[model samples]
Target chain A: SQKIEQNSEALNIQEGKTATLTCNYTNYSPAYLQWYRQDPGRGPVFLLLIRENEKEKRKERLKVTFDTTLKQSLFHITASQPADSATYLCALDILMDTGRRALTFGSGTRLQVQP
Target chain B: EPEVTQTPSHQVTQMGQEVILRCVPISNHLYFYWYRQILGQKVEFLVSFYNNEISEKSEIFDDQFSVERPDGSNFTLKIRSTKLEDSAMYFCASRYSPQSSYNEQFFGPGTRLTVL
Candidate 1:
């Protein structure tokens, strides 16, 4: 069975500091990996997506690195702020037999930025 | 910006009752998906729809669950007989086009369903 795991523990950091989250997977080959920010009781918002061929991707203050060999991805938030406090989820794109793509999400890691 | 939208922010119903969650995805999106997240759990994919048919569905999407694109813009998920375990936040997502090598899905606010 395929499994996606992230740091179950919440990460607390001071504002302006960099927050790094990890996502690891096993027994699955995905074409791409994406990161999303989810607030309590709200839906996930897209962040960054890195394809299997790409080593890293960045969007403004956010950066994501994908290592297919290691079966892992790292998400980094630079100059984090209190508003950045939320659960960060990592999703992998799984191609279905019918040529459709669906997302498989990890348990997610919660980050808290203290001011 | 156009975004996916779901109706009925929250719903409460008794077990074995029928429930229909509605969503209107981005008009130009070609793929639509339904996912559920239980309290404090990871988001689980239920089913994916495209070309007016189901492309893939997870084991969680049993016979009791069905999806329909009744019209061009409306998509719905129906649970014929909801169970207590069915309580969760259901989300609707859309992808602009699968033809793109990398298309990120846009998610809606989600509908919180509580079965008592």
Candidate 2:
């Protein structure tokens, strides 16, 4: 069985600061990992994805790093704003021996950027 | 930009009653998936449908759940004799073929199912 754990249940940071969230997994090696932003009462929106062979990927203000050796990925949002407050979820794409592929999500970390 | 859509944003049903959640995936997507998230919990995958048949399913998608692509644009999930534990927000997702660079699954708004 595979398991994923996020760093914290909630994080509070001042606006204009950088927010870093962690996602650690065990028992499985995924080919790719993705990050999503989920607002209250809404479905998750995809953000960034980093493949195992890649060390880092960035999109605008967001960046993601994948360390396959440590089975960990970090998500960072610089210059955070109150509007950036939302739950961040990390998901991994698992390809089974049966040729089935599924995305498994972690519990997620809620980030609050206050002014 | 195309997106997945689901109907009945919120549904309340009795413990023994049946409920059908509907979804219309992106027109060109070939892989469809069903997932559920209990309040305050992580989203859990239920089933995946491809080629008009079930390709994979999780243990949570037991005998009580069934999925169908009865029409060209509609995908549905039916829960027979729902239980209290079935209360959760059900989400429908779809994506292009795995070979495509845009393989990310697009999720619908989700139908909140509450079984009393």
lDDT of each: 0.94, 0.94
Return the DockQ of model 2: 0.86
Q: Which stretches in model 1 have alpha-carbon errors above 4 Å? A: A96-100, B98-100
Provide the DockQ value for model 1: 0.83
Which parts of model 2 are misplaced by more than 4 Å?
A: B98-102
Model 2, backbone clash pairs (residues 3+ apart or across chains), number: 0
Q: Estimate the TM-score for candidate 1.
A: 0.97
lDDT of 2 by residue, A2-63 (tens): 79999989999999999999999998788889999999989989899888899999999999
Model 1 sits at an interface RMSD, in angstroms, of 1.2
**lDDT value, residue B74 of candidate 2:** 98
Going through the candidates in order, what is the number of backbone clashes in each? Answer: 0, 0
Q: Put down candidate 2 lDDT per residue, B25-116, tens digits, no spaces.
A: 99999999999999999999999999999999998999999999999999999999999999999999998875646457899999999999
What lDDT would candidate 1 get against the real structure? 0.94
| Quality class of the docking in candidate 1, CAPRI style | high
